[model samples]
Target: MAGKLDRFEKLINSLSTWLNWVAGVGLVTMLALIVADIIGAKLFKWPIPGGIEMVGFLGVVVATFAIAQTQFLHGHIEVEFVVTKLPKTAQKVISCLTYSLGMALFALLSWQSFEFGRTLQTSGEVSMTQEIPFYPLAYSMGFCCIVVFLVLLVQCIMTMIRAKK
Candidate 1:
């Protein structure tokens, strides 16, 4: 069981790493688009059509896609000052509980995001300027949330095992 969980953790970690790379690329693409738009507007008196819309889409992609990687890296802000004061057993229990709650929250987020994405797809929702479909980005957000949820679930399980020992 531990081995299986470890394998799953590794798989998710790899996916998170790949997603992080994608986020980086998205950020760079967004930056380039904005710069080009600015230059075109100032020098040529012509701005890139839908440039703002594209940057908005890329911003969503970059922000949502990096969540799993950020969680895996423990890069999220955490105030551990109070936790540090707890006894060993109490701390372990609290850690497990916290991870479990996090998993639940992310699970709900993923489910709702997926539902919203489906609605967007069925409604043919799109960005006004670019007509960019919103479903794909929403689905990506859902995917990232689920990945982060799984990561947290694994952490909760590990913490439980450690507490047992």
Candidate 2:
């Protein structure tokens, strides 16, 4: 079981790491786009059309895609000062509870995002300036949220296993 869990964890971590790379790319792209936009607007007097909309979309990609990797690395903050004072068992319980809540929250976000993406696709919703389809971004958010949910689930399971020992 431990071996299986370790393998699964590795797989998820690898996927998360890949997603993190994508987030970094998105961040860099956003930076370049904004810089170009600023330069064009100020110097050339020809700003990139839909630059703002593109930046907003890339921001979402950067934020969402990095979440799983962050969670996997225990990079997210927790009020550990209070939790550390508790008994070991209580700490484990609290950890499990929090992870469960995170799983639930991310799962719901994934579901709702998918539903919204479908709606957007069906309605042909798009950005005003770029006319870029909204559904792809919504779908990306949904996928990223699922990755977060998976991370939480793995942590929750590990916590439970530790509690049993």
Candidate 3:
């Protein structure tokens, strides 16, 4: 059981690392697009018609995709003073509870987002300017949220297990 859990933890960490790299690439691409748009508008008196909309879409993608990586890296801010003061066992229990709640919340969010995306896709929704489909982006965000929740849950479980030892 312990070995299995250890493997799970390693898998989660590795997956998160890969996701983070993809997120980094998305961010870089977004930056490049923005710069190109600006240069085109300023120097050439030409603007990308859907540039703003596309960037917004990509921004959502970048942010959502990076969430799991951020949580895995312990990059989320928390007021740990109270938690730190507790006994080791108590802290582990609290951590478990916290992560459980996080999982529930994220699960709910992901479900809702997916439902919304499905509805949008069914209706063929489109943006105001570029007429870009909104469902794909929403779906991606929902998926990322799910992934983040799973990673956090795994981390919490691992922490609890180690605390027992």
Q: lDDT: which candidate is best? A: 2
RMSD of each: 1.0, 0.8, 1.4
Off by over 4 Å in 3: none
lDDT of 1: 0.92
Give all TM-scores, in the order shown: 0.96, 0.97, 0.93
Clashes of 3: 0
Question: Least accurate stretch of 10 residues (summed lDDT) in model 3?
Answer: 8-17
List, residue by residue over 1-165, the lDDT tens digit for candidate 1.
Answer: 889988988998999999999999999999999999999999999999999999999999899889989989889998889999989999998898889889989999999999999999999999988898999998999999998998898778888888889
lDDT of 3 by residue, 99-133 (tens): 99899999998999999999999999999899999
Question: Top TM-score: which candidate number?
Answer: 2
Please report the TM-score between candidate 3 and the true structure: 0.93
Candidate 1, residue 84: CA error in Å?
A: 0.7
Per-residue error (Å), model 3, residue 157: 1.2
lDDT of 2 by residue, 87-120 (tens): 9999999999999999999999999999999999
**CA lDDT, every prediction?**
0.92, 0.96, 0.87
Error of 2 at 56 (Å): 0.6
